[model samples]
Target: MTRFQSPFVRVCWYLSLAILAVPFVFPFLWMLSGAVKSQTEIFAPTLTLLPETWHWENYAEVFSYQPFARQYFNSLYIACVVTAGTLFISSLAGYALARIRFAGSGLLLLLLISALMMPEEVTIIPNFFLMKWLGLMNTHMPLILLPMFGSQGVMATFLMRQYFTALPPELEEAARMDGLSRFGIFWKVALPLSRPALAAVGIITFLFSWNLFLEPLVFLSDIELFTLPLALSNFTDAYGLPLWHLQMAATSLAVVPILVVYIAAQRQIVESFALSGVKG
Candidate 1:
């Protein structure tokens, strides 16, 4: 319908999509194929796209080893708790940043934005020592608390702030006239309108917490308390080579659900990240 449009332009667009899709789709396809394959076939440079036999037992063995089910539950519940905590705390902080024109608000926002640029690796040493001194090591406390207060949390805060910045201040002022406290305006008025941003923060925070390995490995030592990512890496034999089948199966289990969610909500999910990234 446009004079500038042509068949060649359409071809180029489709080609670009196929190229972009390969890295995402290929890895998952290969992982699925690899997960089903017998041990001998795992490392083939030329991919084994499919195997003659499907070994569903890999999933079972993954659970049979080292209370995998419990580890999974640990990761799931912790992620949920952390996600909810972040949404509340971040939104509270973000709303204040966006709405309140306090004296040091600019400075506070600068510090928070600066934090987003800092890697967790730099603070891990200090955090690890703090956990050890507090006797919180080898527990889920570090896993939940560190991320809830760390860079990921800062990013979520910024996300909510950016969204709140764009909201009409009239609603907040009107609510205040109706006897709504500052907290009530945030919780009842602004937050309800911030579901998209909150959802984004929740999803990203949950995934980051769920897949977090370095913090868990550094802080948690108790086998019962290990998160899924930590548990995934622990699949090893006497020589320390990976137990391919169990690892693949667990990886598949860990990754597949997230991938499904990502695919199902690709638009919202991607938009959330974009909003967060730009704001953060």
Candidate 2:
């Protein structure tokens, strides 16, 4: 049976939620409004939610001002590649850590968790030099390779490990009895049952790779090769001031995929994290 909250309590809960939601919602609303407003209207002394004149053309200008379509594709393809790579590498490593009996597994897991505590900024300088030596600068290679093997990958591996740890060992034993190889059990049984965790990891990795700025800025110098984040910053005047309207329009487009992914899989993400934490 379901229990319903009292009217007064429900009202108070709704009010509180509305208040809490304002900070997060306001920026998106402002960005949408700003995308259709001119510089003069945007900078007007009096704050207004709606533009006096709707410059819907700003969206069209976003493409005209740069190779936005190419940059968009760059971000999209890179994110997809990174997400795919992370899932494969992290799942194999995580399954090993959780299931395989090996010396130094504990130490390796500890070191990985420690690596998560270290911020990417700390390693950016060394990575920049490394990429330069490897001649991967001014290309998308660093953007794809770094995130696939870096902290984001580590986090995904940790999440997968926790989830895999929670599964019953009997399943694998049964598979083994059926003459399934270790990899066969993982590929057929374990992987199929781990959809929630995989979705969570995929969404997180894609967003991380999509919004990545520091890596792209460091590794890529060519505007033609820039990702969305780097390309967003290129929407500037001769004086390097942002052209706000077009920037906002481009940003609005950039955020659409993120919003769609989150909205669609928000429940899965929450459930996956909760399960992993409790099981761990």
Clashes of each: 0, 0
Structure candidate 2, residue pairs in collision: none
Q: What is the C-alpha lDDT of each candidate?
A: 0.85, 0.91
Among these predicted structures, which one has the highest TM-score? 2
Model 2 agreement with the true structure over 132-222: per-residue lDDT tens digits: 9998889889998889889998999999999899999999999999999999999999999988889889988999999999998888878
Error of 1 at 201 (Å): 0.9
lDDT of 1: 0.85
| TM-score (C-alpha, index-matched) for candidate 1 | 0.90
Which parts of model 2 are misplaced by more than 4 Å? Answer: 1-5
lDDT string, candidate 1, 43-113, tens digits = 65665688767888888888888888899999999989999999889999999999988998999989988
Worst 10 residues of 2 by lDDT: 1-10
